[model samples]
Target: MPPVAFLHTHILVVVLFLVFFAIKAVLLLLNKRDTLDRMRSKTKIVDIVLGILILITGGYLLFLYSGRIPTYLIVKIVFVLLAIPLGIIGIKKESKGLTVLSLLIFLYVYGVAETNSLAMNKEEPSVAPITNTTTELPVKKAPEEITPAEAAQEEILNAMGETLMANAKAIYTQVCATCHGEDGGKGLGGAALLTQSQLTLNDRINVIEKGRGLMPAFGSQLTPQEAEALAAYTITLNTTN
Candidate 1:
């Protein structure tokens, strides 16, 4: 299941439990004759079981799907803990304030869950060239007949192309690996980039340069030649036979 779906299901369960408990507590506080006799039998065994399930599923999503425990979950869990005392007070002493506090805490936890949910939907940033490498290639000498200006232009274009390729790789790692996997074949991230027919070398180049949907445009951040090189490199991802 998707992380979002799992989280939504657990949250819904928690909300249901909170609503049921809140109503029951309110009825008891009012000392309603219709509910007073039945209040003693309204044990929260089902709520406890549902709460445990929510905790288990939530833990799995945090540690497994996202691969890291988000701070938001920790904060939500703390508020949930606080709600426990409020729930106790509501049930034992028929405290309206405690019931209200419990409801407020439930809303706070839901808000935190929504915020953390966005963490999975983050868009990757455009790739930038790494500039600190010490290894330098010797520049080729231009023909004696060629003007210095022409040679300089050629050199600039070559450098620009190289930079684009480097940036493309970085972009691929950031945006594609989650679905295409690190090598682009395992499909661990979502789909196999290497095996996809929609993204030819030229198509990939265009997509990176122009972007489409979830992809961010690299043309603004990368030179055309650099984008071309990165596209070329991506073509070689699954061709190592």
Candidate 2:
């Protein structure tokens, strides 16, 4: 389970014991007419043993959730220490008021502990925008819908040959030049270390998509079109070198 929830469980156990102790202390103080023989012996022993258990469990919790020690836990520990002397005084003087006051302090400690536990348990909110701008843009209408002159000026793109080569050149200069050098001479940071038998276009594309050694995966960062363009561009790097 989560650290905060685990800590809260321990705190709940300790608080239950404190409540029982407080009630017994109050009752003993109110019924002074009865002989204090059995009450004094049993109350002292139970309180001391319970107190030690609380301390031990609290210390264990501190170690388990050591990554984050809330300020509230520190305050609760201080109040618990103060409650010890107040509890002793209540028993000695048989003061009902002191016992009630101790209970109130314990309640406050419980409240703070529960609140801090909830705050710590909460997940952090997301900061990324809902819509990605890089992959989405307004599509332009065909020039045929406009004037005839504009339609005539719209030259057909060579989807397989010249256009592909031009697109490959542009992609290569923009993305590959920083790593593979302008003349494919293995001069970039990682490229400089790679041997002649390093990798082919397909291997390089796989490494870029699924990060191998020092490179981070760009599968999520780059669009499919961008990845394809880069892959095609890389194939032509040493073609004319």
Candidate 3:
């Protein structure tokens, strides 16, 4: 299936699962034993099936983006692992609180994914020197002799660079993820596994700009700098593996 289409399928099943969870939670909370007794067998089986689909679809997408997981994603995965059992046990034991807590945790995961790309866009822009003159370079010094202020400055620069990389990843997610997969190894629709690709940087950039079979050109959609950043991030798909 096309990557976007597969993603849509994944999302659909997720929403369906949440709906089923809500229904079961309400039934348990309201003590609707009569209705539950009547539909219990079918609903239980249906819920199990839905849960399985959710896992399979999620796993497929994760496979597409194997490495280079963001910190927030790690958090979401942890919460999901916690939420599943909580939700199941809560419903079986008729514990409203646990069910509600599980719902909230899943909500957090959804929120993180929705806002991830937006958050990447908010990174601090690179700072440039005001004057570009032949300033005398500082002599090499021992690492232990570095001043506190210099160390702090280095930390800030490092943070900024990290933010830029995150942004680059976000860009790739938006434009290239569909074709390249999350880990850039999906080889979807016969595209090459980017992690295994041997194309040079210039060749990759040119292909992105000009267009190739089954893939549209992105030069008009993205600026040169943006494309360059995305290309750089794509390079990491291999390095990360």
Tell me, by lDDT, which candidate is best: 3
lDDT of 2 by residue, 45-79 (tens): 67677677777766765565423455656787888
How many clashes show up per model?
5, 0, 3
lDDT of each: 0.57, 0.52, 0.64
Q: How well is each residue in 177-205 modelled by candidate 3, as lDDT tens digits?
A: 77667776554433445655555456677
The TM-score of predicted model 3 comes to 0.50
Please list all clashing residue pairs in model 3, or write none if there are none: 64-183, 65-182, 65-183
Who is ahead in lDDT, 1 or 2?
Answer: 1
How much is the lDDT of residue 88 in candidate 1? 65
Best prediction by TM-score: 3
Itemize residue pairs with steric clashes in candidate 1.
164-226, 165-226, 178-189, 179-189, 179-190
Error of 2 at 80 (Å): 1.3
For candidate 2, give the lDDT. Answer: 0.52
Cα lDDT of model 1 by residue, 105-223, tens digit: 77666655543432333222223222222212222454786656545533533454445546656776775665455555533312334533335456777876875432446788767
lDDT of 2 at 40: 62
Off by over 4 Å in 3: 117-241
Ranking by lDDT: 3, 1, 2
Who is ahead in TM-score, 1 or 3? 3
